[model samples]
Target: MKTILAILAGATLALAATAAPAQTLKSVKDRGELLCGVSKGLQGFSAPDASGKWTGFDVDVCRALAAAIFNDPNKVSFVPLTADERFPALKDGKIDVLSRNSTWTLEREAKLGLLFTAINYYDGQGFLVRDARKVTSALELDKSKVCVQAGTTAESTTKDYFAANSMALELVTLPTSGDLVKAYEDGKCDTITTDVSQLYALRLTMAKPADHIVLPDVISKEPLGPVVRQGDDQWFNLVKWTIFAMINAEELGVATNTLDAAVKSQKPEVKRLVGTEGNYGEQLGVSNDFVVRIVKAVGNYGESFERNVGAASKLGIPRGINQLWSMGGILYAPPVR
Candidate 1:
């Protein structure tokens, strides 16, 4: 009887230890800025302009987080990381969150001790070839050299795709996105493969963007989003809901331009979202007007998409399935209430 009681007490203590609240939110508040990991330099996703001001879809996610926590969008220090360096950096406490266009996968979450907040961008793997090659389909690239970033899902996905189709492949794996682009541009490889959105962004860096084309064939589902380390439920919830709030704001037609009107809306959902009706933000460890701060900083998800990589921007990628659920896409978020 004594032994059984001791074992039961040990089990309870272990469970309590495992369920301890994560200190990431408090750490960010103490540090006075968020340490955000981003891609080395993926245009329209996370890149610094000539002025060194970071602006892109991924960059805006971190900025919105900063706004939600500090009420200042600029309270974030962007740390550029390569495909191989991203996870280790986040796992080692080098960054508070990673928003570098990383694909959310089971292995990454379970094996790497990381957690993806939400699918901020729905993407798929695709091929990019110079128009001069006249390659209209990825299936035609048999025996061709493919340039892909090493340590990325693209590397493995490309290999599996070719093997599955019984096509010959000569893969030129590089260490960074820039290296892959340079290799392709220098004729070291016949084509490059990555997320379709990245292909579009990379094309803009070429000498003649019009000379490259992203093939219509999509090979893999790449649900990209911000990632936080595991064991920090508080931080995870904050990050997850920050994205959800932006998505929900878009669905509710509460963009930055319409945010003031949303605050005055009598609708229960809008009131809860704008923090006039409930303590949802308090529940998340942020100010009651957290959603408003996010919208004011980065606008809604659609607004950020349009401004960075969508039709309104140079990338000109269509909304396609990234559109709001009610607007014919899969982008749906839970209500604030």
Candidate 2:
């Protein structure tokens, strides 16, 4: 009986070890294309052009993952999801990864059984108002009607901020970002509140983009990043490290423009990043040159940022805190070594 029990236990252990890679990665590999959840139509983060081509910062993250996995950035299906639908889609296995600009909060992970991989954008709650309103600060708008998207941290944060400051707030809560913007444009509210990054994006959609101004006051911390389902350590690590690889590439000055030289780099960190020195990508269940694939597809984090939402883009938002740690921002990644 003792021999039989020992043999059964060993068999159980073997099965567990075999299942260690988790189902998400295997399913993605089998499907031949990654299902990435993105915002419904947030320009600069994730939006479909007139030709139905998706492009933006968040879209690039999904493309980077596809490039890492399939060596083809185009091997991805972008699923547009609303704020309320995003989490459920991810939880229901409708999407493999959520690259929507979602805020990372404790309640989301602990309550929803999801995991935020990493904070790709550091943001804050801010207000946007028509420049003609003559309001330069969020605190100055007393008894103002504020438009915010429902089912988002922005709605709750706006409420808390108003109450804390002893200001009267007429809240106009909308179901989607489009609704919020429409409400704001239709004079349904005196101001709109959301993440500072989002506010910039929203402003661009206005009839006269220069007529509105994003307030300088940042009320709450909003660390936005990619999210994956919990319990899939392999998938979680892969997504997290994918973002890290982008950040590290930017720090190492290895971008899409310099990718050819990066492959032959002899620097210890550069070698590991370019896959000439170590098997870091293989350990993540991808090709050893996964970083090369990612960089080639989306350039690096900074490149994606500048191209989609930074000064080079229509938004013209400053790099601010999203810059690399060495360049006075909090953006830092673990060494590939």
Candidate 3:
């Protein structure tokens, strides 16, 4: 009888655990603003303008979520955080979402009690050296002093990469990206190593931007995206689908300029995407036209990318792997229906 009672107790506890609710959506709704954690100032990703208005690829993700929930892109509060403070702020509920330029790794999701929603940017680590160095590849970076942020994957990855290539590495660690940039500019390190996208962004901030060149060789795969505190499946789904919806919109050729025509499209995929055919958005705790609102306010993924980081912007970084699956790159999103 004791063994049977023990089995019943275990089953009851399991049910109770599964029954615990996710409060993120309700808490954000009640709070009247979606608090988002962003980088201190990564230009193409997340940064505030002179007027203190946040605008960039990562910032738009937060604004897209706000539009989906409240039909207002301005219903978000941007919290600028450093590399070390980002995860803790999200875990402590100080921010509803972390749209910082953080890479999604196994240890981060499994060990840090956080969930990476989706890969918003496909990036890889690379080296940036002075143009006068006449260096064309990463292999040319032997016996160099590299500048990198202290508390980042790039720090360990730099060591591993140099060790694997039989190159001697002298690391110059700084507390933040800004510090690392200053160190590199002040001739503290021979080379700067970080995500290629970051290298592009940081280089533009330098006094002599044209004097540096980013090497073509990429070392580590850095799949960067938005993150949320673990155990909130509802909030997770909301963020994941928001990005997917934008990608899908781009794949279907539903852009902001042609939004009205997209809504009137007779094709089934277009109909489903523009809310003329399905209740998909309702299932995710929003109205059927949630994607419409997102596209209207922030625009689809391609528009966001172009406006912030692509050829239209000062960064001029090509779409490359961030392009849709249909367009040579591997960025595949699920169907909205």
Candidate 4:
């Protein structure tokens, strides 16, 4: 009798622990909104318009997830935060996912206890300098004053590169991107260091974009993507595959305007994605129409990105590293079927 009681108790505890992963679906359904963390007005990335509506590449990630959950993309709350605050916000459950332009690093993954869903943008760090400086290479800026954000991975990366190369560069710490830009404009710093995408975004807003240029020096490979708190494999998988659905939609030629026609698509991939064939969404605690809702809400991965920050946008960034693998870039998604 004693042995049986002990065995039953152990089994019950094991089942209880195993069942915790299944609760996130119910909790999100009860909440009715996806809390999406974004940046504090990073132009093409995340910002509010005159109508006070948030729109950008990062914002689309949030809205897309909301569509997957409630079948309504607009059912989302955008929580804008700074670089220093975004990590803590996600970890504390203040936001469901960090959809900002956050880099995926082993230290952040293993040490900070965070998980990256996928690498949406294959980016790198670079330098932006005044055109009159006539300096094209990063190594040529020896002893040059450089303005960088006070606390960012970009700053540390810049320092490491300079130190390893035995180059003496003055590091001018700025509290924000705006401040760093101002310092560079005022010639307080001969150059400014940041991610190449951010450098272009900032340049587009400057009074004289022609007077400044970003060098062709990509110092580091920054695979940036969405982030969520550590633990809870089910929650992580939901965010991960939702992003995958968007990417896969683009690869399969599915879009918001073309979704109606796609329902009739006899293609195996399209059928699986549009809920005409598979039950993948059920595993993620969402309806079978989750991918359709996401595609219809925000088009596809390429559409959302290009509209916000691609060649047609003010940022004028080419889809060099972000293009699909078939297109000679690294963007790829696993098989949906």
Query: Which numbered prediction scores highest in lDDT against the true structure?
Result: 1
lDDT of 1 by residue, 1-337 (tens): 9999999999999999998977999999999999999998998999999999999999999999999999999999999999999999999999999999999999999999899999999999999998988988888999999999988899889989999999999999999988988999899998999999999999999999999899999999999999999998889999999999999998888998898899999998899998999899999999999999999999999999999999999999999999998989999888888
Tens digit of lDDT per residue, candidate 4, span 237-333?
Answer: 8889988998888888899888998889999989999888889888787888889999888889999888999976888789997888888888899
State TM-scores per candidate.
0.97, 0.95, 0.96, 0.93
Q: What is candidate 3's TM-score against the reference?
A: 0.96
Cα error, residue 151 of model 2, in Å, equals: 1.0
Candidate 1 vs candidate 2: the TM-score winner is 1
Score candidate 2 by lDDT: 0.93
CA lDDT of each prediction against the hidden true structure: 0.94, 0.93, 0.92, 0.86
Please write out the lDDT profile of model 2 over residues 46-149, one tens digit for every residue: 99989999999999999999999999999999999999999999999999999998999999999998999999999999999999989988889899999988
Per-residue lDDT, model 2, residue 7, is 100
lDDT string, candidate 3, 105-131, tens digits: 999988898999999899999999999
Q: Which model is ahead, 3 or 4, in terms of lDDT?
A: 3
Question: Which regions of candidate 4 deviate over 4 angstroms?
Answer: 1-19
Better of 1 and 2 by lDDT: 1
- A best-first ranking of the candidates according to their TM-score comes to 1, 3, 2, 4
Name the runs in model 1 displaced over 4 angstroms: 1-11
As for candidate 3, its clashing pairs are: none
**Candidate 4: pairs in clash:** none
Instruction: Report the candidate with higher lDDT, 1 versus 3.
Output: 1
